[model samples]
Target: MAKLVERRPLKAWERLNILAFLKGMRTTLRWLLKRPITLEYPEARPYIPDNYRGTPTLVKDIYGREKCVACQLCEHICPAKAIRITPGPAPEGFSHIGRAPAIFQIDRSRCIHCGLCEEVCPEEAIVLQKEYSFSGTDRNAMMIDKEELYEAGGTLPDKYFKWGKSE
Candidate 1:
């Protein structure tokens, strides 16, 4: 029977070179010389882009009606299932069974902040606010319901996109 030999571990000098600290120190020095990329983020707000997509806000018409047609197109378009909608009653005094969302909620915790919902809305019922700071103390506080979303939603001005027209 032949005896098997175990190989010894390589010495530190013989080991492959990896710059873990040197590169980090270099980056730190560069950053120290340059202006900070961020300030007191939570306290100090920063400027936002015109097409910035932060949180989903629900829109309503001047006629006191929700802009959402309850088409479920936004729900279908969302990559993250952050939006929750339940069917609601039709327009009052009208026999036609039109659709409305009984419960329209957006879970900020699960949202990716993608603008797909805004893009897919036929009636332009949903939009992302210029406001980016979404910090909250409670878990439920982050979950914006219909009323809260509506309140957060600023005026529906004409949207201007650099790439294309704001639909």
Candidate 2:
């Protein structure tokens, strides 16, 4: 058996729930009066920090020669295994006469942008640029060859190479 206790009814003001509605409206109005921070993308490019990392590239020496010795360190260290290289003797007339890569390729689709290849490169042949916008219709189009890497790296500034040592 249970007792049936009677309780008082709710007040009329409490039943309307006006406070919650007013708070919501106030928030909406406050936001409506604020200005947006968006920019016209094509006309004005967004600010990229100095330390920002975008795409990995293969750099060259000051003498306009390929810097990579084809050590395959980057290929072995890449977590995504996006890098592939074929080792060969250095090009004719090259002063270094060291081992170079006959074939160097990287699959952008498989790259995770971890920056490990650049960090581990002893010859400082690989570096990451600030280029962020790139599009490809097909998966194979995303693959980058040795020539493409050289082009993407562009010309390294004199300051980048100091005391015959690349930075």
In terms of TM-score, the best-performing candidate is: 2
lDDT of 1 by residue, 17-123 (tens): 44656778898999999987887966877888878898889876544556665778888788998888887876675343377778888889878989999988877
lDDT of 1: 0.76
Model 2 residue runs over 4 Å out of place are: 1-36, 162-167
Residue 20 lDDT in candidate 2: 79
**Which numbered prediction scores highest in lDDT against the true structure?**
2
**Model 1, residue 119: what's the lDDT?**
89
Alpha carbon lDDT of each predicted model: 0.76, 0.85
Q: Return the number of clashes found in candidate 1.
A: 0
Candidate 1 Cα outliers beyond 4 Å, as residue runs = 1-43, 91-97, 158-167
